[model samples]
Target: MIAETRIALKNAGKYKPEDISTYIDLGGYKNAEKALKSKPEDIINWIDEAKLRGRGGAGFSTGQKKRFTNEAICDKCLQKYVICNADEGEPGTFKDRIIMEMDPHLLIEGMLIAAYAIGATKAYIYIRGEYTQSISKLHIALKQAKEKGFLGKNIFNTGFFLDIEIKLGAGSYLCGEELTLLESLEGKRGYPRIKPPFPAEKGLFGMPTLINNVETFAHIPYIIEHGVEHYRSIGTENTPGTKIFTISGDVKKAGYYETSLGVTLRELIYDLAGGIKQDKKFKAAILGGAAGTFVDHTVLDTPMGYDLLKERGAVLGSGAIMVLADDRSIFEMTYSILDFFKHESCGKCVPCRVGTTQLLLLMNQAKHTKSDRIELLNKLLAEAEYMDQTSLCPLGQSPILPLKSIKQYFESQF
Candidate 1:
């Protein structure tokens, strides 16, 4: 059975918008109810106690970000913003989409908890342009939340005022980055920024802002209501809470499945995904997403989490695993993944912009001429290795992870 997410995503898809009173009846706003009664420091303490880490691709700790943003808010700024990043643009990661569609209310409750802890009265959930259904669902839920006592002035009669707005994107994958996301929110073209002035310090139009993934927000309500100890029992010591996996390709049951962290990749594909169809032999798996690590059968038993994947030379990422079996051409996979990075580079940096285009050209040439294949492999893998670590942003870097790992594991197939 799938283990339920208690802290962040408890009320998603289970309740309607007009049912805020019913949600309150069913213990929906209990966390906020309690937070309103307790000190702001206590709310921060609770999240730290829960060990609630960010489920966005970055996996930064929410408690840590909150602690930083709360501290960074200037004495002059009157408007602090808590932002929910709903732009789920990773190629194979659709788990965030599922939670946004199913449980927007839980997200709102989480927002309330965040606003209370950080002294923010305004929040926005920026969704992708492609997610028409999820955007509509968020709009409906936000409107209902305003009508109920859960949102607006004096929430639950506590004199705390919070309002949430929904914003739509033009569908750029780079906007998934926190800085680029803030840029887009301000009606500018999305371009990632340099660190040392990370979003926690100066974000969302030069004000203190906190941006978290949809899955990260969905987890908040459960953590606040159930407390941290119960939530910590589900996953690893450092990586607590159930994770939503979006597994695709060469699998029978390709969809969203929420399971505890540290669950084996074998269990995900073989048990949860029902294994390969028509008895096809297993070849490899793409742990994370298109821009993530490649795991051959040799590493299939590795547990899923943050530190574990890092040990296996991967980052676990947003938990979007793509299974690949025999008969698929490694050359084709390499070309396709490179092509995607080439198109999505945003041209903000030369290494990624020029490098991806060159890789694509070399891939095209390699496809036709067998002699150029080895040369292309060396050039692409070597350059990609350099780019992954040295690029201006994670986008430029991760585009080559799949290509390099594929070349390393399945050299014969290419």
Candidate 2:
């Protein structure tokens, strides 16, 4: 079995939905309250000292993001907004859903920490529409938070008043991008805007907004209570803290598992996920999500995180690790992933919008001729190369990378 560590999911699968006291008792809000009392620069210092990186796809430094948010909020004279991106659209990624549904108060506490740290007056939890149970749980916990004065005006007798709203996303995958998410929240079409004026500068109706993944915010209380050193002790020195991964596909014990930053994919699968079911042969593993690259069984021993995976031409994209056993067909899986991209492509860029359909058409015709399959493979590579270089945002940019990586690294069925 894998010797995994837990942090963001600390209370997950171990707490009642409405148990605010359990959260408080388990060291929640201590960080936010401390941050509320401490100097803002000190808070930024603590974050940078801990070396906490974003758990989102980009894996940016959380400290730097917070510093930027603090600066933006101060300059704009805009009441900051804290948003929890619980719209886990990547297939094989279920950590966010597990977090929100299992320990709703943890999500709430995470939001509160952000509000305190950034001087945010309001917060929003953007959830996927498919998370019915998670939404119900959060709603109850939210009411409890408001009634207990943890969320309403002047929290904990401090001048920080934070009202957290739970917003339901219609599950448009394009909205997973921060800017696109803001547009969707405003009841507009969920399409990404060009960057330069990032969300930290202009977000949520031109306010300085700090958006974080559920797990990233969840680490704040722990960091405050334990100090930066304590948080750094568990994971790699630079990439400190544990990451929650959602392992799926034909594994023996597929589920969510939390491990330190340097944990290997082999340790996660063969040990934590109970290896291939019935000890079936391994074909390949998709690190991150469908947007991530593929790795063969030999490379499964590689570590799972931001830096190491990049060395392998992949990324730890949202901690969604999917295992493909020998019995599964790569053609079918690749096609399904491409189709999902097509449906969620937002039509904002021509490369992703038209390119996906063209790839699909070629794949459909590949059933008859070998040359057709090879031609489709070449086109897939070309499209991915172009998309990565020219697309407006990551939505179109990443749709084809996984397929191209799979084709290059793994033996796909023609």
Candidate 3:
């Protein structure tokens, strides 16, 4: 058995993405029509019952987010927005790009359902600039959807209107942050806004907004078509439905694989991804992306789910599993991750701005004594913890995850 589920990626690599006829034949827009006729609260309730969480790094409740936007006190602004976060810039993560490239219509259908549920008339897809093929495919798909009346005014004669626009990002990793994405979509520099006025209250031109990743949106139509009970039956009780994992680095099959949330890491590597490359022993795996924690080989049997991994100080962040072979240097890998964060820090907060620079400088110093290196490492970890508490947005706080996890699991390499 493959021991994998194909919910979000069901249409991927199985049909021509540019053709609407191909998508329609596979029951593409059927759930979208269902959503138009159903009450928004009914859809939200079903999602809540199914326990569908965000496929984004946060793992927040998707139904709760929609409910918040629906019930938000938006007296100041009458309009609401729905955003598709297609900016798959996280290192070792490319699942969203595949969906946009190979199954663009699925994303469109999911977005329509979400918009209808949240009562949002306007939506935006903030895609990465590097995704030329995905963008092109989404463009064609959007045009087809509009022409077929799956989008635009009076969709399916239900008097519901939703217009989705595409905004290409300039490859700023910080733009993947929901607030920063809103700023970028509004033609401002990509900098994260402070919390207290969360996106559910004020977002996207000072209006309520519901933001979710491409994969999170893609599951909506499936959950709506298939009952919530059916969706819940696939995965564990807490994290129901399937997840799309992007395995890279030393894996033999370095690509996307969709499976239930609670599958063992051993099965994912050996059974699904053809095991480590060159028959080498697995030294470690970075669950999630650069902002994710590192796991040693001993934890290969650990279940891959949100709550299960959280107990081990790990995350299924965006479903990225970067396999590291024994030959790979832990120091070099840590340095590379730190470098990405150093370059991508938005500089809006002092803790993140200074912490990333200080960490990089300490790691770059080659002439330090052994004791000095250890002392510097301790200070860098302190700084990372401080950043986690004080940083304005997730970009500033992300450095702590890798730094702390690497220090815990691979400190001897330092």
Candidate 4:
């Protein structure tokens, strides 16, 4: 009976998601008003002190990103932009969709605070087109906010102006990556851009842009509304705040649960999610989504934080935990995962394109080959490592995560 520690989801399901009045009645836009009066740099400092990290798999510091975007020098006439990544394309990860559908106003308020902090007057939410309910809910919520003066031009008579728009993604998994999403946002093909000029430097039509995922932005209001000390008190010292985990597959109570950062897999699977389905033996769990690690029961007690999981050579990517019962086949799951990477590769880079295809081919060949399973695993690991080094974007580099983890934990399945 482990209870959820809700923060971003605090207002979810408590009122009409599309109604601005219900959100306001619950003291929703008060933080935005409070933030409007405070110095933007102070807000950024609070975030930095709070140690809020991006919830979008990368786990980068949110405050550092804001400070970079705020201090970044452009032509002065060039306007800064704030972009929210809502492309929820990760397999088995639906937390963003839940936030968008259940508490769209919270997201809107968070974006408003972010726009003010970074001096951005215009913002966009690039959501996956497949999220029809979320899109509709966000549209309604945006309209309501605008009507209530929470968005668009001067708010609380403070003279700060901001407007937000929604952009639909065309079902490209690579577009979920920030750089690729930037290219797509600029009406270009979805492809990862080279680094050094990160989004905080040149982004969204070649201006200083601040990009954060839906969950990352949704946490802003809470961090601001509650003091930094309060926020830092919830999760582990390094990784503050709760995370919305989307658990599915072989779990009796498979759904999204928001818990503090240090919650263990054992607590998540057994206490929160009610353990494996039908009292079946737990075989393994995918700690992240498709491009995540596979772990056996041995690491159940390990805490589910970014640094903690990374210490175990696992990633708490997108907070997507997919449980597997003993009846599931690891080889079949690995093949399917490889196949997904192969199909999703944007083919813009050689390593990822060729690497994904070759990896899938190797898996297909493994089905018929009488060769030593260890040798096959070694071969897959070698190829994936090469891709990790040379591939341009995360898509090109992601196959190695699952492949390497599977090789480490489930070699017998080969």
lDDT of each: 0.80, 0.81, 0.89, 0.91
- Greater-TM-score candidate between 2 and 3: 3
Model 2 TM: 0.95
The model with the greater lDDT, 1 or 4, is 4
Candidate with the greatest lDDT versus the true structure: 4
Model 1 stretches astray by more than 4 angstroms: 1-13, 17-22, 372-374
Candidate 4 per-residue lDDT, tens place, 286-339, comes to 988999999999899998899998888899999999999999998889888999
Model 3: clashing residue pairs? none
TM-score of each: 0.94, 0.95, 0.97, 0.98
What TM-score quantifies how close candidate 3 is to the native fold? 0.97
Write candidate 1's Cα lDDT for 312-339 as tens digits: 7776888898888886677787778888
Instruction: Answer with 2 or 4, whichever has the higher lDDT.
Output: 4
C-alpha lDDT of residue 18 in model 3: 86
Q: Where does model 2 exceed 4 Å of error?
A: 73-76, 372-375, 411-414
Tens digit of per-residue lDDT, candidate 3, span 20-126:
98899988799999988999899999988888899988899999999999999966778999999998889999999988989999999999999999899999999
